[model samples]
Target: MENSKSWVIDPLHSEVLFKIKHLAISTVTGSFRKFDGTIITEKSDFNNAKVSFSIDVKSIDTNQSQRDEHLQNDDFFSSDLYPKINFESTSFTNVSGKNYKMSGNLTMKGVTKNVELDVEYGGSEYSAQGQLKHGFEITGIIDRKQFGVAWNIPIRSGILGLGEDIKLIANIQVSELA
Candidate 1:
């Protein structure tokens, strides 16, 4: 893999967030407390970069301790059995400007499904420490039931307690791995 240079994800400089509609009136935003990722690219523009990412289900936090515990149970992530959620890139399609579409397989709760992530190249810069750094913003949407986390509540208002589709967003920063 000499042609490809691997970049390590700077977890401290990155963010993994998700949002879903709650009660059909409000939106709930949450973030994973633990995750890691890496990018491998041979070209400087990252047109064909290979991406891999993982998020710890046990680290999911939605503010309320009760809610967090519930998410970690069988109703949702089931962190005890499948503690990690992973994504591996299959292809990258560049659109106009810095926009791109990344197709990959996302595995969650022991189930894997194809997903497409919207990626935006944020350019690159040299850190004060003289390390080469790259930035990217990625977003995607997925159905909770598709991953075997099909827990829903029907309300009297003819609405579900939570939305089926979850929006995922990530602001990633990486440094060239020496």
Candidate 2:
């Protein structure tokens, strides 16, 4: 790993969001307030970068106290048993121009599954404090059932209480480490 540059996520400048359908009609949005990650690369272009990220399951917030607590229970994340959601990239390939495809293993609730996420590199900039930072927008879709979050209820006429597919959106800023 000689000549590699390391970068760490700036929590203050980053956010992780998720959206899912509720009752097969309304969309419910949520976020993980606590998350951290690292990126290692040999080139400034960031092609083939190694990425590792984790989210604190207990930090899940949907803006509703009761629903948030329910999400932490066995019906969803089971945060007590699985306290974190982890992702380690296998490949980060440039698709075209600033677009990239990031394939990785995502682990949650004692289950691990391979997932591919779309990434848009927003280039880099230097903050007023002179810190070098890179920006990226990431999006992906995953089946909750694949990660052992299969709780659901029928709501008549073939509707479900929650959707199986969840959409993930993240805006991340990582600062270069000296």
Candidate 3:
């Protein structure tokens, strides 16, 4: 029993961003400009809805051309070998007012780990173009080493070249498909 509400992700209006500590002194932020996914709702219960998403590993952008290139190399994401980061939901539970806990399998660098996302529904309405749209904001954190992304350099000051934890934030907009 599906919710009967099909939604298509509007990549132009959605963004996937991440942040990590660089040397424990500064925070490095970046985003992937090209990624897309769909949302299929199952109305058995609002808490039973399913969710999934995928991102292109090669689309990483940190506002620096050289760093982006390095990330695509073997030192980091190894975009040539694993081209996509993906997630598929397994369960959902209501946590509190407007907040839901979503557990899913996240695959990156060929390693799959169970991850959770804090989801908040931002309601739905008709857009100016007369299309129904739904909004959601989700946030989660993943340990870089868990996915075999352990490359790092140790500084004499006790800081590492790259942080172990990566913070993920996503603002997604989906249009109702007629």
Candidate 4:
């Protein structure tokens, strides 16, 4: 962790997405429209990294206004009270070529849990602007109820409600800061 430098997320080229099974036959997908993260590392391989990010919960978008609004309310994320979702890396371990195991603390609605992310490093490159950049596709799954978003309503179809599991993904592109 010596001589570490910070690399910032390029918001224009990065995204955070989540999907959950709705009614057992359908999927509800959403994205956090606003987020930012930084990685502090001393090596190009990123094996030893400190990463963190904050996502604006109110920016959750599923392309449906009504559903999106409900997600930001008390029964769900309760964005008015806890407006930010956060993550801080605990460890980043390389599994092989492009594969990695990323463990971190993920918090939502004031509930925090330890989660592991599967990351695929897409390598690094020099951009058209001549900046060193790194790319990654990260994925993880967590139980929504564990995060205090435990809203369940049964439907006539006997579908119960939304599924307990939530799958998350992040396609990130970051540039080194000199």
Leading candidate by TM-score? 2
User: Which segments of candidate 2 are over 4 A away from where they belong?
Assistant: none
Candidate 1 lDDT over 1-178, as tens digits, reads: 3477899999989999999999999999999989998888887677778989999998898898899999999888889999999999998778878999999999999999999999998989999999989888999999989989889999867789999999999999999889
Candidate 1 lDDT (Cα, whole model)? 0.91
Which candidate do you rate higher for lDDT, 1 or 4? Answer: 4
Listed per model in order, the count of residue pairs whose N, CA or C atoms clash below 3 Å is 0, 0, 0, 0
Report model 2's TM-score to 2 decimal places. 0.97
Sorting all predicted structures by TM-score, with the top scorer first, yields: 2, 1, 4, 3
List candidate 4 stretches off by more than 4 Å.
156-158
lDDT string for model 4 (78-134, tens) is 899999999999999999989999999999999999999999999898999999999
TM-score of each: 0.96, 0.97, 0.93, 0.95
Q: For candidate 2, list the clashing residue pairs, or say none.
A: none
Better of 1 and 3 by lDDT: 1
Question: Candidates' lDDT values, in order?
Answer: 0.91, 0.96, 0.86, 0.92
Give the candidate order by descending lDDT.
2, 4, 1, 3
In Å, residue 117's CA in model 2 sits off its true spot by 0.2
lDDT, residue 35, model 1: 96
Task: Write candidate 3's Cα lDDT for 1-178 as tens digits.
Answer: 4545667789988899999999888899999998878767666334766777889999999999999999888878889999999988898777886788889999999999999889887777888899988787889999999999889999867778789999999998998667
